[model samples]
Target: MTSVGTQEKTRPCPRCGAGIGGDERFTVWCAACDWNVDPEGPRKEPRRLDRTRRALARRHGEKLHAGIVSGEDLRARRDASALLALVIALAVHGVTAAVAALGIWCLVHGWGGWPMLPGLFLLLLAWVLRPRPASLPDHVPVLHRAAAPTLFALVDEVAEVAGTRGVDAIVIDGAVNASVQAYGMRGRRMLVLGMPYWEILTPQQRVALLGHELGHYGNGDVRHHTVLGSAYASLITWWYCFAPEDDPAATALELISNLLLLVPYWLVTGVLLLLDRLTLRASQRAEYLADRTSAHVGSTEAAVGLTDRMLVTDSVEAVLAREANRAALAGPSGYRAAGDRADELWERLTSHMASIPEAEYERQRRVGALRGHSVDATHPPTHLRRAGLIAGERMPAAVVVEGDRADRIAAELAGARRLVGRRIILDGPSFGG
Candidate 1:
């Protein structure tokens, strides 16, 4: 296996198509490509790096698309896996339930002598193995149709374009991110639109973001995620349900029983880990396909611009939040003035970013290379997405609304913004007052 440095030397410059010299192999900047390589990786021409990244993204997208196109088969396989997991869970509980019933019968009858002991033990085991329903507490505020008509209308339009059912509800929060997912046994689709995230983008960019999220539904990615998630949850619950108590062993029998219990825990955990690893690549591919859908619905430029702005917006928000906290600490009045300070800082950051050239902005943005496969990651890395969007074919922009109409639509969410702000302050610790 050749080292990365040697491979860099052998590859041609992506920009000028010039051969990289031996000295340039170790340098950060490629004289020919005029691009800086990330310090984390071997030096390579920027354009070449972009090309490689794009190629890999495209391949992943293609495979995912192929799987999606065979929708019936994919669904069948997912259903089978889910059914198998469900059967296993039910079987485990069913056996415990049977044993408990037998124990109860023995206790009720005149057979309470030795039969009561096994019956009581079996009852305890059944109690421990009882299934626990998955519950996720609602942390963000959810908006209704009457409360956020404009936002709902915007979502409806995007859903129509993306060919998915409209979201059941919209959640507004203070984070700088947006997402769509299904929840509850009814599988109600919910759109989580961050107030800070919405404030940073133009009308077109917002549509692109909405389209990207809604695209997940159209491509069946949401269902895929749900199946995988449910299966993993069932396995984990089973593992925990039978987990041995933390009490120290008082005798050889107790020690043996504790050791025996660990066997099922490790086996279930190993299966869960393996499943996660196998599904991670597919999850990343779903993200890329969603990006493609966004590009198709709202132009490649809009999709790409949203990704770029996201990187800057996160940094700007962090800096402003810290500054606001510091000011609030100084005086009582500062607590009331924190919002104004944040607005001022945000404007400055946006203006500075706008004034910079695209190349300079790209170089300055601290995005890393495409991430390798990981069991825990649900989305592809930002840098890989940036490159892929850049290489994607341009499409005519899908205009949902523009000019004063867009402004009016955004204005309708003022109440939501206030709610989010109040929630943030209320939930947060007091600085001075």
Candidate 2:
């Protein structure tokens, strides 16, 4: 009665000699002895500066997580580091204002003279140095409150529980992630849901995601604020302006240009690095606060589930890749119309996610701890976040999606689901886009 498809390939772990099971195409590791887990280790950073930043972020992130687990409050305060970062940001803005004023003075005083050339140059520089406000991304379709009333209603309910105003727009995209970001100088918020990620979540975990994102509004993350964020952008601009090209062979003029720019380049780089260090701790703190908010709004069990799902985001991408590869190998016959693919992709994704083994989840946790795995430089490791959530206070769900309401929300997202699914099928996975 045994089918060929049901047979697993077995191998001995080189380190522990424990039996490991997997198909030929999949990686197999010994779950009992934890051998070959996280075999590749943490990804290497090619740049020395980037490597240093990541090391420091990981160290501080670990300390912050430990504090949270030991009963430290998740709320961010006006700490010394945050205050210094704010002061530095204000100074950066002051420099921008000075450049603009000097440019204006040059034009007003020397209207029809040789100074006009320098005046125009200065103005151009000032324009390039100006602070940029956040804007809506063009890559994804925007859903207005009118079009997605049911989904917006759910977001609004989560926002109320998380103690912030809801978003102005919802962006549905193909990535396996979700985020809330401020747009425009007015700081109007927008929530982005990556349907690939959203489709794999249980209904309550979706609310947890909403809570975590909206919680950023009140999380006291100085770097996400308009002033500080724009200031950082301005510093990056200065660094780019003074940075030398990496050409091995160069003319004398290019060599002299690099020499002349060296001092300013270092000056900009030092300040940029300093600003990053000053704000790094507060940023990590804000993430913990957001995680707490997620637990508060969606209940601890749901929030924990959400964190576990984050740990398996790469697995979701692996499933999509397998589907892509299968289609390629099958030639024209395997190709499905965008409509058919869109309709079926969500079901396939949910099934794969639901079937992930308990042993695999535990293995991933161990790997996270070993590698200091994080969503990015700003967030703590997933294992630590999960631990913090488990140790923290539990609460009843402040916002729950009833069965009918969940169905209604899904109906509203039908068009966007198809759009995102089509993108994945045609273009592979567009992560963080």
lDDT of each: 0.59, 0.82
Per-candidate TM equals: 0.63, 0.88
* Candidate 1 positional error at 268, Å: 3.8
Tell me the tens digit of each residue's lDDT in model 1 across 1-433. Answer: 2223443244566666765433332333444555444445433434432344444444554455455445422221233444454455455556557867877886776364887777777677666654433333376677777877777877787788777778878877776677776677767778888766776776788888888888887766632455445555556566676466666645778677778888877776666554544454445566766777787777888888877775565344654465556665767676666555545544544554444344334543443433232111345556556666766567767745677777677577665665555444434421110
Model 2's alpha-carbon lDDT is 0.82
Regions of candidate 1 where Cα sits further than 4 Å from its true position = 1-139, 222-227, 233-265, 336-360, 364-367, 370-376, 422-433
Task: Quickly count the clashes in candidate 2.
Answer: 0
| Window of ten residues with lowest summed lDDT in model 2 | 1-10
lDDT digits (tens) for residues 339-405 of candidate 2: 5776677777887776676666777788888877778655777788888889888877899988799
| Top-TM-score structure, candidate number | 2
